[model samples]
Target chain A: MALSTSSAITLNINGEKHTLPVDHRTTLLDALREHLDLTGTKKGCDQGQCGACTVLIDGRRAVSCLQLAIASEGRVITTIEGVADGERLHPVQQAFLDLDGYQCGYCTPGQICSAIAMIEEHAAGWPSAATADVRPEAGAPPLTADEIRERMSGNLCRCGAYVSIVQAVAQAAEAEAAQTPTTARQFSGPSGPGDLAHPAGTTDAEMTA
Target chain B: MREFGYQRVFDVPGAVARLGADPDARYLGGGTNLVDLMKAGVERPALLIDVRELPLDGIETTDDGGLRIGATVTNSDLAAHPEVRRRYPALAQAVLAGASGQLRNMATVGGNLLQRTRCGYFADLAKPCNKRVPGSGCPAIEGEHHNHAILGASEHCVAIHPSDMGVALAAFDAVISYETADGPGELPLAEFYLPVGDTPHLETALPSGALITGVTLPPTPVAAVSRYRKVRERASYAFAIGSIAAALDVQDGVVREVRLALGAVASRPWRAQEAERVLTGGPASADAFAAAADAELAAAKTLPHNGYKVTLMRNLVVAMLTELTEEAAR
Candidate 1:
C-alpha cells in the first residue's frame, strides 16, 4: 500500500550482465523470476524449508528464496536456465531426460541445478553424513547410492520420482567418470575386452590396420 | 514485506557505526533466517546492515592449538574444513546434522548462533507469542507444543533455541568475540545467552550495535572421542526432537572427565554440568551414564505434548556416552 524504495543493482546471471531496479525487500528468487524473466527456477515455498528455489552462487548451491538480491551482489548467479552448453543439455539434464526423473516437473529445475553442484561437490571430496570416513583417502569419493541420496536430501519430489532421480544422478556420475580417466591404466592401454575391437561397420582390413 | 534501507559495510567499525546510529536496524549475515522471518512478518527491521562481506570469512588455528572461526564462514565451509573435521568432529557433525545442504551452504556461523526460536507460535504473526510481542502471551504453553522446551523454561516462554552449532560450542566451552561501539570484547558461549525470564525477546547478552567478529574454540583432550547425536522425527533435513553433544575422557576404564550439552529440549543449549560432575571419577559404564543423565534432567519440566522429550533426551545421552566409551576402547 506504501511506496517502497528500490535500488539499482547489476546481476551476472548465466554469464550475462543485467542491470535492473529491484525492491530492497526482493529476494534473489523474485528478482530472477519477476524482473529478469528467468522463470526456470521455480518457487514452491517462499520459506527456506523447501529446496525448489535452489540456485548456484559462485558454483556453490544455495536456496535463492532466502538470499536477498542486494546481498548477492558481485557473485556469479547460475540458475536452471544457465545449466546447458548453449543448445546441448548438461550431462545431468540428459540423464534426467533419459531416465524420466520427473512427473509434474515442478521441482525439476531445482533438482537439476542441485544435482550439478552436488556432483561437483562429491568430485571435490566433500563428505556427507553417510560418509563413514569424513576425511577419506585422496581423490573423488565414491558416489554410492546412500551418499547420493544423502547429498541430494535437500531436494524433495512430491510426485515420488525419487527413484528415477537417483537413477539419473548415478547414470550421469558414471558417464562423467568414464569421460574423465581417474586412473593411469585408462590412459595407458585398453584393459577391457571391448577395447580395440572393431565396430559393426568396420571392415576386416580396417580393423587389422 | 515492508520497504527498508539497506547498507553494505566493508569493515567492522563501519558496520558497528551504522547499527549504532539506528537502534531499529539489524545486522544481516547470510540472510537465511532473518530474511525468512522478515517474510513471515515476524521481524520488521527499519534498516538492514549487510555484514556478510566485512572480510571475516577465514578459519584459522590460534597459537594455543584452538580454532578461531570467522563469523561469516558458511556452514558448509566450516563443516568441510579439514581441521574442524579432525579436531572437533562433534562440531562438524552438529553443523551437518542441521538443515539441508543448500541451507547449510548459505547459513553462517554468526547467524546460526543468533538464530531465533523455531516455535510455530513465534513464526505465526497472528498467534499470541510473547517472543514476538511483549505481554501478548505464549500460546505454545497450552497449545500444540510437541517441540517446546523441557528445561530452563520460565512461565513467560518455553521455546527452544534451534541451533545444533550452539550445542557443540557449549560442549567445547567456546568463546564469542564481538566489537561494540566502545571497544572489542569476548564472552564465554555459556554466558552469552540470557535466560528466558520475563522478557523472552531479549535473547542474548549482546548490546545494541554489537558486531560478532568470530568464535574461538579451545582445544580439548577428548576431541577424538566426541560425538553429537540428534533424535529427530525424520531421518534427514528435520529439526531435532532431542539432541546431545558430548566429549568423554576415559582412563583405566574410569571416567577422567566429560563435557555434555543438550539441544532442542531447552531455552538455550543446556550445559549438563551436573551430568559432567556425576561422570567424573566414576566408572565408564552404562550405569554411570544413566546416573549422569538422570542428574542432568532432574529439573526438567515438560508440557503435555513434549513429555516424550524427557525420555528421548535421557536415552540419547546414555547412547552417546556409550558410543564414545566403545570408540575409546577401539
Candidate 2:
C-alpha cells in the first residue's frame, strides 16, 4: 500500500498555530511565503547557499529553504514578522532603519533575524573564527567590525551594503547590552578595559557623550 | 522536487528497522545536503526518515575521559560545548571554520561527516561523474580540475572531501559508532572512510543498513592545544582549497608528540602519519617542520591542474606546525 505523501501539519510559528496541508516536498520557506502568507521571510537561494531565507527555529537561526514544512511541525519558528512588539519595532530593525543598513532591502529580514541571534550567541560567550581566544576564561570577545562581519556572514547583501549593515548590527548589539547589564559577562577584550563593552571604532566617551 | 514520504522516528532501533524495510528510504539529518541534492535531481529517495528528533542528540563524557558526540548534535552546539572548546579546540575550530552560523545551527555532526563532494560535475545531472554514476566518466579530470584531489585518487574519480571537521577528527583518532541490523558496532575514523581504489561510489565502510549514532573521541592531551586552518577563496562561508589540522606536544624544544591531517587534498582526510614519524624526537624547528611535511607529501600524485595543492599542503603543514611550536614556547 502506498503511504500518504501530504499531511495537515500544525506549525507553531510566531506564537500562533498555523494549520496547513502541504506536500512533503514543500520547503518551510515556501510554506511561510506562499501558504501562510508570511512573506517577511524572503527566499534568495532555494538551496542553502544564500541566507535570505533565514529564520529562528527554536531560538536558533537556520535557513528555512532547506527545512521541509512537515519536519517543522513541532518546532517553534520565529520569523521577521514576529520580531517586533506589535507596532514597536525591534532594536535590530530600528538600527537598520536608522543606519541605512540596506540598499535594496531584499535581504533585510534575514539580516535582522541573523543579527538578533548573533548578539545572543555572542552574549553567551560563543566564540567566532575572528575571536582571538576561544577559552571560556576569555568571556565574550568585543563585538568588532570583523566579528560582526564574521557572525553575519551567512546573510549576503547583493547591493554591497555591508558597511552600514555592520554598523547597524553593532549598534543593536550595544543597545541590547545596555538594557541587560550583567557583571560576569564582561568581555576581556583584545583592547584595553575602556573598550570592553563598546565595539571597535566606537569609544566609551562617544557612547556616553 | 519529486514526491517522497517523510516519517519522524524517535528511537534508533525503530529508525534502523524502518530503513531496513524500505529499499530506497534515506535517513535525513538537517537536510542541508540531501534536500539540495533532491532539488537538483541528484537524489530521489522515495521515503525520508527524519532522524533529527531521535534520542541520539547528546555529547557526554566516557569513563576514559573521552567524549561521545551524538550524531544529531548540531554543529553550533558541538562547537559551543564547553568540554569540546576546552578539550578538543581544533574540532571546535574546524566546525566554526566551516559553513555559516545558520548552516551550523542546523547541520548535524553525522551529516557533516557523511556529506558528499561539492564537485560541479557531480551535481550536474547532464555531466558525467564517476562518483555520481559509476563507470560513466569524470569530466572534472580535464575540466576545472584545479580543486581536484592531490593524493589517493584514480582515473575513476578525483573529487576531494569537503569537510573541515573530518580533518580534525582524523587527527585526534575519532571513532564512529553505529547501530546495524545485527548489533551495534564501532569503526575508527581512519577505517570508517574507505580508500578510493577503484570505486569512488563506495565512500565509507558503513554497513548497508547501519545508522550512525554518535562519534567517540578518544582522550588525547595534545588535542587541547591543536588548531585547524583552512585556506578558502574568502575569509568565511567558502569551501577549503587546502587546509591543515595539527596538534603538537613539544617538551624542552623536542617534538614529544604530534597529530596531523590534511583536508581538501584527497578523497578522505589525509592523516599525515609519515610526518608524525619524522617529527617524533626531532627538534621543533622550522627546518624540521618543513622536512616532515615534505616526507608526508612525497608520495602525493597530483593532476596537472592540482599540482599547486602539493605546495599548498606542504606550506600549510609547516606554517601550522611552526605556529603551534611558537605557541608552545610561550
Candidate 3:
C-alpha cells in the first residue's frame, strides 16, 4: 500500500512494515520503544550524546534518538531485535556474547548495531581519521586496540566493557570478511550514496520469507 | 517539559520563513549541538525548524579559485574533502580534532559556527551567566575562569567561542553568507563574530531573522603549508585549552604572508593580526615567531584564574607558526 505523509507513516522495521500514527516531534527511538514495543533499542541519553540508542538506517549507523519519526519515513532500519535470526544470533552478537563484550547489557544493542555498521564501513574502503594509511592492501588490516577504540568512540559503556567490546567488533569484522562476498553487502540507495527516497512498504509475508 | 514542536524545511527560504513567522522557533541542523543543549535545559525554543532536509549540503569550489561550503555540510564531510584536506590542512585538522566520529557525522557547519559558549555557568541555566541571561552576572570571572577568555575580554563577560572550525576559518580569511527576511549579505569570518564589548549576549552579527547560508574561503597560497595545533585536557572529545591555526607563506627562508589565529583563549576567534604583521618580511626563526606571538598576547587581559592562558597561548602560537614554516621549507 502506498503511504501518505500526513497520515500514519509506515516504517520498515527489521524488514517488517509496521504502520503507526506518530507526532512529528516523536523520535525514532521513542517510536520503536514506546509505540511498537521494540525495546531492544535502548535510550541512554535521549539526546544523541550517548550511542546507546544507535541503529542502522539504510545500512549506515545513526543515533536513533536524534532522528524524528517523520524524517525516518520509508527508510530501511535495522535494530538490535532484527540482528539475529529466529533462533541464531548474528556472528557479531554471538561474538559479543562469547567475548563478554558487555556488562549490564544496557548498551549492548547499540554496540552490536554500531559494530556491524562499522565493519561494513571498513569493508567498503571507508577510512577513519585513525586509519594508518588511506589505502591498505586487499587484505584486511587487523583492527588494533587503538583502531577499535577510535572507531567505537561513539559507543560508551558506563560499565567499562570497552576492551572486550572492541575485541568483539574486530573479531566479527575479520570473521564476516572471510565469509560474505564484498559485492553482496554493498549498500545501494535510490540514486547513490546520500540520496533520499521513499520506498513503498514491503509486505510482511515477503519480508519474512 | 517533554512537549515540543518539530518542523522540517526543504530549503533555506522555508527555514527562514518558519523562523520569522515565530520568534520562539529555533533552526535545527544536525541536532548534535542543539539537542544536547535542549536536553540539558540550556535551550528552551518552543519550536524546532529542522533544516537537515534543506538543499544546503554541498561543498563546492567558487569562481576565482576559492571554496564555498554550505552551512548544513557535516563536519566529517568538511574534514575529509580532498580539496579542503589538501589546500586547507589546518581547517581539516581542526575539524578532525574536534568531537568524535559520531558527533562529526552529525555536526553541521552552521551549528558549529553558531555553537554557544561552553561556560559551565552558561550550560547550567541554574547558574548565573551574562551570556545565558544578560545582566545575570558572570560567575566564571571570579570563580573558575580557567577555561575563560584571556584576550578581547570585557568587564561584563569573557566567555570564549568554543569552535575549532571557526578559529581555522578565521585564520584562512573565510566569509559567512547570511539570508534574512529582507535579503542576503556576506561578511568576512573575522567580522562575522562580535566581541563581548559590554553586550555579551549578542554574539554573531547575523541580522535578526537571518540564516547562515554558507561559508566561503579565499584561496590562499599559504593554505598548502598550514597546520592546526591544539592542546586540551584529554586526547579527544574535549574543548581546547589552547589551540593555534597558523598558515605561513615563506619565500627563501623569509615569511611573506602569515595568517595566525588563536582559539580557546579569546572571546571570539582571536585573529593575531599583530603577530602576522611582525612575521611578515622577517626570516622564519624561533626568535621571530616568539616575538610575534608575544606582540599579540600583549593586549591580553588575563584574570587570576586564566593567567596560564597567556603563557600557553603564547607558546602554542609560536609552535604552530614555527611548524608551518618548517613544513613549507620541506
- In order of appearance, the predictions have TM-scores of 0.93, 0.95, 0.86
Q: Tell me how candidate 1 scores on lDDT.
A: 0.85
Task: Give the Å error, residue B246, model 3.
Answer: 2.2
**What is candidate 1's CA lDDT for residue B63?**
97
What C-alpha lDDT values do all the predictions have? 0.85, 0.89, 0.79
Which docking class does model 3 fall in? incorrect
Order candidates by DockQ, high to low: 2, 1, 3
The alpha-carbon deviation from the true structure for residue A122 of candidate 3, after best TM-score superposition, in angstroms, is 4.1
lDDT of 2 at B225: 82
Q: Name the TM-score of candidate 1.
A: 0.93
By TM-score rank, best first, the candidates go: 2, 1, 3
RMSD of each: 7.5, 3.8, 7.4
Measured with C-alpha atoms, the lDDT of residue B160 in candidate 3 is 89
- Please write out the lDDT profile of model 2 over residues B1-330, one tens digit for every residue: 778998999999999999999978999999999999999999999999999999888899899999999999988888877788788888888999999999999899999989999989999999998888888999988898899898888888999999999999999999999997799999999999888777999999999988999999999999988999999889889999999999999999999999999999999988999999999999999899999999989988888788998999989989999999888888
Which ranges of candidate 1 are over 4 A from the true structure? A1-4, A135-141, A181-209
- Best by the TM-score measure: 2
State candidate 2's DockQ: 0.46
Q: Quality of candidate 2's docking, in CAPRI categories?
A: acceptable
Q: C-alpha displacement of B280 in model 1, angstroms?
A: 0.7
Residue lDDT tens for model 2, A1-209: 79678999999999999899999999999999999999999989889887999999988899999999999999999999999999999999999999999999999999999998888777767788877667565566788778888899999999999988988888888888787765445432212233223222434443233
